[model samples]
Target: MASELHEAIFMAKQERHKNLFLNYRNLNNFPVELLKDEGMQFLERLFMKRNSLTTLPENLAQKIPNLIELYLHSNNIAIIPQAIGELVKLQSLDLSDNALQIICPEIGQLRSLRHLRLANNQLKFLPQELGDLRELETLDVSMNLLRTLPERLHQCVSLQCLTADRNLLHCLPRQLCLLPDLNELSMAANCLTSLPLDLGRSMELQFVFVDNNAHLKGLPSYLYNKVIGCSGCGLALQISDMKQLCLTLGDVTVPLPSEVKAIGSESERVLPLEELACRVLHAAYDWTCKDVKLRTPFLMPKSLLDVVQWPLGHCHRCSQPMFTIIYPKLFPLRETALAGVHRSTVSFVAYCCSSRCMSTFDLQA
Candidate 1:
């Protein structure tokens, strides 16, 4: 095996091959022969999958400086040297199925990187500098020990697909909803109790998976049409748990109600002062419209402006802008038409601006 491996590398060097495949080589370390004598400068791609290699040489970039793709999947690699940042032209990197506990922040220097796979690792957290990869399109950090994702990841403007399934995430960064090009999101098997309200609001986002979240009883209405996997949710609901999921609008913080406040029509009820003010301000500011050509300079405080900018969410029934409060209506998945399709036990929560919409809103409709 050793002779065969050496022969392959020798042949590649003699021919100045642009691609090198050394998979299943039973190698325990990066072959020193490849890094000798100026290295294979012409090598553009390297495959070293399913190896016993534990670490990459610090001078790897100096030797194979032109590498565009590096595949080191299913290895025992525990650490990535900072020298990896020197691979400015690298476009794809796969460090999946490894023993990595931390990623060097210098990884941000890979300005040309488009895809990064770090699944099946022992990572506890990722660096904030990962957001610097403006060209990043796909990021997979599944099957790890991550408790939270970096909020700065929203800067990956070109990102389209993000997968963090089977992690310890409790909540996602709300800024992630601002990704303009993001289309698919998967967070199945996490400790998430609630999702960002703005999730799936983007037209580009078409698929969302949150299956097996036993504590999550409700999903934002925006994800109603896009949610593809949601089985094994709504198994438990506690009033104490709901209290922790409060929605803060401007200076007012409202706890998510565990049950419907009332069961009357709109005319039979008088709107709360806070709710009424929110509705009036929303209309005055034309908050529902995508474009606002204000005729005068708006002088509202930043706190109030934030409320108008980000409402609780649009009413699921009337599509009216909801702020300050929400009349939540829950529906069992088995009773709804989606039950047969998704096979989920999770109950869906529909948000309404008033009791009227809440009474009339139909999950089937």
Candidate 2:
């Protein structure tokens, strides 16, 4: 009876049953022994989804050398071994709904990989080498806590769909729109108030879901007239002349009130002008004036100050402040603010609550 059953399964494979669905049956380990004994050589697709799998078997890549599509999703797997990269012919991989925290950097070796899904995982960030997946066209990395993207992400010239919605992305990687073939981008629930000036560089873009961004106010001139619908289908857009649409953020300079002083270990020190500009623009710190002199009625620009009161308390316009008791540093949203700045960074005057007051006292003017 056992020999007859094995022969029947092998016969099914010989009849071109390449797609196998062995999911939801509490499959612990892959049926490697059964498959090897049956001599099933035409296997190309395997589905091990919805299992109680804690980890993959040690020799999975060796057993499924010809497998083009593998689905290990909705499992308890935590780690994807680097050996998985040996499957050079693999085109699609689904590891979503797992306990994976770190994406193996060796995944870039899958030269034929086109669809990679790591959604619904605990990944904090991706490997910088992920840009090496030159053939990747669809990548789903949503529902994670990724703060920033790797700078080399622009190398994936073939990427068509990138879904990174519902993450902690403060700013979209400017290089994202540089992909000439990219079509869809979903960045709904993030802190992005604006997109890259060169965002219109992509010629194939069609749909963009940028709702739910509380801080976002407007789009570039080229994208202004592109807002289409705003209902169940979401506000879609069909843009033209991408080269004329995207524009970089304008260079705007404002003044601060109080004299900038570098807080030191023992004593206060004056910072250099060049270094001060870098820090003030990029690394503005939150400070409370313990003894401030109201020079001329404390009138500040609304663009500079988030809040201002009688007893001047200034929370510098910066990214989220990582405040510590001994030392603290504020990171800004724009990296260009630090452009052409010096090292051993000095303290520059950030938005002063009394900017208008200070302007009235301008010596040259």
**Which structure among the candidates has the greatest TM-score?**
1
Cα lDDT computed for each candidate against the true fold:
0.74, 0.56
Model 1, backbone clash pairs (residues 3+ apart or across chains), number: 0
Per-model TM-score on C-alpha atoms: 0.66, 0.58
Candidate 1: worst 10 consecutive residues by lDDT? Answer: 342-351
Model 1 lDDT, residue 241, Cα: 37
For model 2, what is the C-alpha lDDT against the true structure?
0.56
State the RMSD for candidate 1.
16.4
In the range 214-256, model 1's lDDT, one tens digit per residue, is: 4565567676555355431111233343334355555545443
RMSD to the true structure for each prediction, in A, is 16.4, 16.9
RMSD in Å for model 2: 16.9
Model 1, 297: alpha-carbon shift in Å? 69
Q: What lDDT tens digits, residue by residue, belong to model 2 across residues 187-213?
A: 767666667756644557655565555
